[model samples]
Target: MKTKIILFLTTVLLSINITDRGSASSNYFEADVIIYGGTSAAVTAAVKVARTGQSVIMVSPDIHLGGLSSGGLGFTDTGNKEVIGGLSREFYQRVYEYYQQDETWQWQDRSEYGNRGQGTTALDEEFGTMWIFEPHIAEQVFEDFINDEGITVLRDEWLDRKDGVVTEDGRIVSFETLSGKRFKGKMFIDATYEGDLMAAAGVSYHVGRESNDTYDEEWNGVQTGVYHHNHFFPPDGPHIDPYVSPGDPSSGIIGGVSVAPPGEKGSGDHRVQAYCFRMCLSDHPDNKVPFPKPDNYEPSQYILLLRLFESGWHERNNFFTKYDEIPNRKTDTNNHGPVSTDYMGMNYDYPEASYERREQIIQEHEDYQKGMMYFLANDPRVPREIQNEVKRWGLAKDEFTDNGNWPHQLYIREARRMIGDFVMTEHEVLGNREVPKSIGMGSYTLDSHNVQRYITPEGYVQNEGDIGVSPDQPYEIAYGSLIPKKDEIQNLLVPVAMSASHIAFGSIRMEPVFMVLGHSAAAAAVLAIREGQAVQDVNYNDLRNDLEADGQVLEYSD
Candidate 1:
């Protein structure tokens, strides 16, 4: 294991192009634009900046690039394909090209696989954009992007948030990573899911749901009475006790249940939505990695699942409903029912926690997920019928090949949202208000995963904070949402954590949308540099013109 890691690290160090031009005095490199995060958005941002004839560097905390897109989220949540017309579409086009070759279909025959994608056509030979794919294929696409564009990428370089970001008069002068490498740039983009770079740059942000009244949005807060997706207990369904000892209040709360009262409906709290890995599982025996018991595995921790299964045994098939099979008989398994992958209420502190603590949380989630899969496959408590079905599937050994066949990134559905010059509210997303200075378009449904799992007042197990509000049509993503206020920061732009209320963010947080915004943010940054203007002061007219020329669908058809 150590040898594999060492060899992989050496290969990565050799493969990536980094400009460590100042090794003597804390290795520093200057660029016209600096991008943080190794997410798909980050890579696309670098590509856009580079194409515009500007020098750019991507300093990533992750060893792998393209974040969740390369990490196991092959089942993309792209809403309207026509609205996706920029670099985001270019990526899918590359996927399409890769799969057209006979070599790309190694695990399965092209004639055998036929899972037409969720939103856009997956293997569309006409459009030449394969929306769904394997994780390794996505990673390869991102690598190809950086290599083809000649964009420098510094992998595994974590930003030192505390003392590394040096700001002067609302502009980021330079930033240093924990490894003592420094980067100076005219513009910076935070494309990380965590919004770490934006927060470190003294950007004001929100981490949890705001009150419904705060934004006049119906799906903003507590949502005690509302259920959007089928991730909650049916109100009329039979009661499932949320305690280890049934109906005993004195007994401690169950593993997944919170003791606190779900606050008033539409009220605010500090709880964030649940996160999980968009796991890649395969039924092919030769390319399978059986679920392994994590080092910190505790059998008793999954007792709640036993109860859930016991209560809903008749719905056994429903448990496997979310196994969205991609090419090669591999599945992009996601959280479906109320008791699926999401570890509810366990990730509240992750947004602001230290890296070590965040890692611990991530490991705990990984263990819980893996252990649950193992339990279903072998536990006596689980029905033999379900066990037989689950046992047929295992990790896709061909994917995430380096990390024990585990996903390289966690599915961070929600995190810190920057409070920029314009906060995109539900009004704008739902097409009630006009979005001025359009930069990109978002059409995905407002889909938020469960935020908290708690015992209902009626003694039934319930998961709150799962919302799914569809937009009226594709809405424009405002340019102001990506940049800080004029008085706060002038050079930094945040595409991933752009200003939005919780409900609005739900629709805008899709991978394809992130890439679109990433492309837009870079275009704006390049224009700002050419004009010697702050990001906040970039001319919307000229910026819009450039974005349209670059194939960004900033507005839907009139």
Candidate 2:
């Protein structure tokens, strides 16, 4: 009997020990903040939290950082540089530091390189501002932030949306990844462009363009009359013949024109702007990775481009240029001209699709784009000089070598956005109204890439929803946009997919702006944790004070 009792006691003790160890291991992390998404903002937020003496962990799906900032968008779309402040400014400073080294220019000499080396005012690196650069340099800057701030980074850890647990009392008690690794944190931030974690937490969100009637936004959806650029051919000029069949209607509209019924003019639609990989091309013989024919190459895709060239639509040389110091031989080639690059009207279902479906969509876009490039370079229908010029440029050998020299990142310009307490509208963006709880500032032009391609009544192909309206004055971004409705989820904060209409988000989606908001959100989260209140209950005065002290520009004028 004595031996049995001892054995039972030992068994109980061992079980208790095992249980305790499991629980402790599951809840091992106790950081003041945990940021989701590895965007430019995520890096800035992590750095800010560490600077404030709080433990912070950044969980990123991306192996690289800085989103589009370092990805391939070297031409910074800074509206007003004066409004940029704090750690946001510091990031540009680091970009300046990167170019300070003579070794950064192994491909090109200093004399031959143009003014791309002049850094922003904050760092004064004499290198050009932080608007753009090669992908590797951006990655190096993010790596530097991690090393300097001692941030705990877990890369490629996707949140398990279906069963990822969030507690009843409003705290993100624990979240499990696809790999079954659990992470527990006191405060959580949804910093992804898609707002994936926020959605998983049962937070309400809005996808696609809202109707003009819903938000009272003039520029909301199905903007038929608005012509922002020379994307389509004017019938009178040296314009291309707009019809594939001339008089017959069965031949189908050009590739870049919309085929769907144009929904109500002011009503909402499922359409979102197209996305494409901004190919970084080089002309240097030694560095250029020549364009190769994609495996699924199709000649039919380039028919519109060929027709455009034949019709005298000659704006093919509109790719954004960089400074001489940054190697003028290289070009930051983006989606240009009608039927040039943007796979417009094809991404309507991306926001709500399943993960497996999303992967399929991404691949489809890639194959289509790769085939488009191959067609332009090799097809006989292409103008001889245009084909020759296209062949002269190829993918930059130094960029994105992992994916067979294709850009690893996709330009998800806008995705799932939280329909939070205060939805930012064009009224606030155009300076008609002021956002009361200003947490950050955005100065980029109210820009939206073409949302639809349609053939008009005159039989001319047209691209719509490509507005680039400049802000009347530098505007304030509200803190309310970051917080979901108090009744929905009190603890959640969304920096990337914050409350904003589709048109409004076009301005706010800049990479630097995301970083600024990310830092601010982390700061607010830390404050809320310290005060022992929900994020919505945190004192605005205190939050504003901390953000201001940290150099976040809460409000901007002219």
Candidate 3:
């Protein structure tokens, strides 16, 4: 009787088409190309594929489209504008178009704004069209790409890195998301700054700076001799005391000093540059979100900033410069003076941490930054005039409104980089050497923010690793940088993780460069699919011809 009952239940389950209890049958969604990330590169890659009449899907973890470009980073860092072409140029052109409309400037008049939208001399005539822009305008362009190209975008769907289902043939058969949705594609482009997909695919990548010996390059790690940016106290100014203990060893070093042994000058260490929220602040009272004290606010955290102010180190020049005549009193305030909001040396573990731990770190940074602002504005210790100046500005309400009026995106300047076939070193960037098979070009200054905050031996705080070296001329970005070493991953292209040294990547990592590389990578991916070859095996001559025909610049000029 029991056997019959069990058999009856099994028969009923089968009849109901229930294969496994509480588990839905696995399914796949198909696309010719899949671009992972919501960055400028992801947009360009998807648009390029769609323009070629191929089906493409962009899977982004962001609710918004453009990464930093649309996320309150209005001031663009376009290196060599000439190297920007194809869809990348089209993006800037679209920004120009958006500004041309009289209605676009409801907050400010068009005549008063002048030609600030035209950008600087760095713009390439054949390709460039106004690089600097507002956040909303950038978002509009990305939205236009999606609407016009018919590209499918899955926003807020994060990739499931572990056990994400890559077939044995080395092709990414399908990638499952955290929510159990599967994205199946023939070719994949890892356009994220974090290189999450590339790491998940088991591709080899490097996170910290490679030691000087490892790369045999001059600038790699432990660069104590190099102080490119003016982070230290000016030589002319009265030297600020660096510690709570005067000449005593017990008080500990002032903030922003390296605690570790300087390490091998050229050896690799687990340190990526700094990260900050590119705050869009406004003086307009009606549109400003007044600074609020963070929940975990602590007065002691900002002692260094207070000390700097106490020593008369007051200058607002550290705030990023703006293009002339842009409407709306909004400033793209970046990480300024030491101890001013950038949680230096605290983000080292973020790239590799679990989601829960990353959240904690993000919260910690948020608190540290928010508290810094509040301290500047309301702390009794601050100078009255400085506090008044800070009070004049607040978060832009016209910008990101979802996260309590905070910018939706965190500025993750750099993260895990794929150590692919071609590692673009400083020699390739400084015109000391050239890379073969150019697919794109980057001309921005090799800029790195302070990596560590340590106390100097003199008891004063010192910031290190903020280097800004200009590339005298534009340089070609190697095609090899876009592809993985032939054997690791056959069908993957990493425009964001393109082969480049830390310093070279400092320039190539710019939004404009990423977009250019994205377009090139997509074009190459489509060609590879048609020609039946791995991405590395794609014919360079044919690829170059196609890129040029598509309006990509491969060389740099004055």
Best by TM-score: 1
Clashing pairs for model 1 are none
Which ranges of candidate 2 are over 4 A from the true structure? Answer: 1-30, 116-129, 235-246, 252-257, 315-328
For residues 233-275, could you state the per-residue lDDT of candidate 1 as single tens digits? 7788755787778888888676878888889999989989999
Tens digit of per-residue lDDT, candidate 3, span 66-154 = 88888877777765466778888889888877766777776666555444432363122354366666677788899998888757677
Worst 10 residues of 1 by lDDT: 17-26
Q: Write the per-residue lDDT of candidate 2 for residues 1-558, one digit (tens) a residue.
A: 999998788656644543353465542444667788888888888888888877777888888877777677665666677777777777877777776688877687756755442233222344344555666777788889988876777788888888975666666776777866676667888888778898898888888888988888888877777767655455354544345676566876655566666666878877887788767788888888878777877776666777777766655444223211134356667776666677888788888777788788788788878888788788888777778878887788887878777777778898988899888888899988868888889877777888887666666666677777877788899989989888887777898989999999989898778888888888888898889888888899999999989878888654
What TM-score would candidate 3 get against the native? 0.90
Global lDDT of each candidate: 0.88, 0.76, 0.76
Tell me the spans in candidate 1 whose CA falls farther than 4 Å from its real position: 1-26, 313-317
The full ranking of all candidates by lDDT, starting with the best, is 1, 3, 2
Report each candidate's C-alpha RMSD, comma-separated, in the order given: 3.3, 7.1, 7.6
Candidate 3 worst ten-residue window by lDDT: 317-326
